[model samples]
Target: MTERIWKIGTRGSLLAMTQTRMVQELLAEIGVRSEAVILHTRGDQLKDKPLWKFGGKAVFVTEFEEKILSGEIDMAVHSAKDMPAKTPEGLVIGACLPRENPADVLVVRRGNDFFGGGGKEKRGEKKADPASGPRIGTSSLRREMQLREQFGLENVSPLRGNVPTRLEKLRTGQYDGVILAAAGLARLELDHEPDLVYHSMDAARYLPAAGQGIIAVECRKGGATEALLRHLNDRRTEVELAAERGFMYGIAAGCHEPVAAHAVLGEDGTLRMRVMKYGNGRCRYFSGEAPESRCALLAEELAGQVLAALRPAEEEEDHRTGSRRKDG
Candidate 1:
């Protein structure tokens, strides 16, 4: 009897390739054979603009999804964070690999003293001027908003490119610092680069995007391929991702929205989630817990609370603006 080899669709970037290889290795360990088929996506083509400006995070996965639907590939591997709030009707996330460090890290050129005396100034101490503050580069609106609002970092600019390109920009003084996911640096083994200093942000204070640091394998809803991919699913990760993504969908969040959700599963099977949403010039946060089995309901409950809190403020702003227009 001969074994079957699976065709895996993936993007061509170094990070994408590296993540796909990790998936391949996991599949191989389970006696499954697979090959990577690199697909150039629209996201790769438009590097000059931010992701939100064009079509949100879905741009990166659309081509691979089309390929999967057309049966060109048996399955597609993607960074779970890149997944949009809703999955296409015919497809489903077959597995979520064990998560990496979900925290975002701030990387700065070595010897920079922007943090004042002992790295990071005390909260509420005088803030640096936006014009004079150290330049920090990041493409994520969530990170940029948190940097300015929470960390008092005012000078953040949009930077778009792969991990290496972003780091290169920092190396050449294009930016004094950059915010990057710690998982990428660890996966690429760039966390310990001698010339760069890494400050791991507190996840509670600076929440990560939903599904951050997870690798998701998507396949047609039901078939042999789906059965095979199930072997790679980590139960804890899948549950955590479900809750986080549920929260995202509950809020009707888009790539342009500065939203974040992080869920932690404890040994006792309790699931705790922290979520953040930015709207109408304000940032709102919510936290809740439930049994692992009821994660989805908990996420929905938290999201409802968030929306309820934001609506009154939104209506008040709208009324105030309308009144101002009438006076004018």
Candidate 2:
């Protein structure tokens, strides 16, 4: 006798479907049966408005989660970056897969995948670079501000849609280049195609959007999915993601706030954190190291210091803007 095939709920996007398919294949290899149940989420419907306008980080996960609570789906699969630091009611994130590059990359039109590598995009090879002539598109204010503040590139701005859509925009010259998760391009198997060129960034020089390349497996709290996910969980990724998200969540980072953080395991196995915050046409950074075992505490402390450092100036600017609004 075989167990019933479990159905996993996910957003109905190409990358979402691809990732869910991978999970199903992984389960099949273990002799467990599973299927993908696609759902259209509110965040999926409104691509033009920056996410922060409507609840920030949790917007993408809210609809699917409602179904999980209703028993319409047994589980939900999400990009770890989109999940909030605090668990939603009656739900738990049961697994964090081993992370991919977790670094952001700059992508150009499909014609540039191999300018320097003999047309072979290696494990770390990029699909494009941020050359001066190409107009780069990035959906994140965090990416845009940093690219300008730190990289001196003046053309980057917000562009919406999933991986393929963004790539199409780039291909059509809506942008000479765009920024996307390096992990996303690889996960969808579009990384090595000969027609595209992209540049993966150095994390030390560029702090990545929080939890950029990890996936979160969510299920009803204390449910069977929890028991199953425990098997697929990667312990180190779990700790690192938790700490990075802890920092972002601590500062109450919303889509509009423009924040980024990346936690990496040092050679000594401790967690080293890099954080970024953007406001009023300026960007600032924070860094720290802690024992991986004490990640949560360290993340909280660092988040406070970063925010405190920026808040005073931000508030004064806010006050000035409010005064102008009143005068108008």
Candidate 3:
């Protein structure tokens, strides 16, 4: 009898390859033969433009998802954050590895001052002044908005590239600092660098993208492939991500929406979620907690809170626009 081999499709970046290799090793452990098929996505090829300008996060996963749908690959591995709020009609996230650190990090040049407060006190260093607008590099609208509104980063600049490229630019003095996901840095082991300083942003202060730290294996809706993927699912991660993604989907927002939601499992088997929506130079926050078994409902309730909070502001804006048009 011959062993059946599965094909895993993924973006061809170093980080993507690293993550794919991790999955590959897991499959190998169970005597399942699989090969990684590196696909150069529009997101990878169009490194010059910011993600939103390139038509949002779908650019990163659409090709891979299409490949899966076309049966060119058995499955596609992706950073969960790159997935759209709604899964495409023919496919779904069949499995997800255990979640990693979901917090964002501020990577700054040596001796640069941008963030201030508690972390510095622990280091016995003076807290950096909040008003010193360090030139921060990031393409994420969520990160950019948080930096400008919360941290007073007046010099936010557009930066697009993989981790190594962005770090090199930071090292060469192109940016005073850069924002990156702590999970990716930890996965790449770039969290500890002699040339850079890392600050793990507190989740209470900085909400992460929906499904930010998860590795999702997506596949078509049914059959042997989906069955094979069921073995890879981490139940806890699925529940948590369900809540976070539900918050996103309920609000009809995607990666480009300057919205972030995160869910954390509590010691008592409950789930607590935080959601933030940024607009008009400010942010509205909503939170809810529920039994782990009811995460989906909890997420919907949180989304409702966020939407309710935004109604007044949105209506005000609509009224102002209508009045302006009438005058014109």
TM-scores for every predicted model: 0.95, 0.87, 0.93
Instruction: Please state the error at residue 263 of candidate 1 in Å.
Output: 0.2
Highest lDDT scorer: 1
Q: Write the per-residue lDDT of candidate 3 for residues 236-297, one digit (tens) a residue.
A: 89988889889999988866788998898877999988899986558778888999988989
> Considering every candidate listed, which one attains the maximal TM-score?
1
lDDT of 1 by residue, 1-328 (tens): 8778899999998899999999999998988899999998999999999999999999999888899999999999999999998899899999899999999998888887364355466221235467677788998999988887877788889999999999999999999888999999999999999988888888888999999999999999999988888889999999999999999999999888899999999999999999999877857889999998899999999999999999998899999999999999
Q: Which stretches in model 3 have alpha-carbon errors above 4 Å?
A: 113-132
TM-score, prediction 3? 0.93
Where's the lowest-lDDT run of ten residues in candidate 1? 119-128
User: TM-score of model 1 relative to the true fold?
Assistant: 0.95
Better of 2 and 3 by TM-score: 3
**What shift in Å separates residue 186 of candidate 2 from its native position after superposition?**
0.5
Clashes per candidate, residues 3 or more apart or on different chains? 0, 11, 0
- Deviation from native of the Cα of residue 227 in model 3, angstroms: 1.1
Clash pairs of candidate 1?
Answer: none
Model 1: lDDT of residue 272: 92
Candidate 2 vs candidate 3: the lDDT winner is: 3
Q: What is the Cα-based TM-score of model 2?
A: 0.87
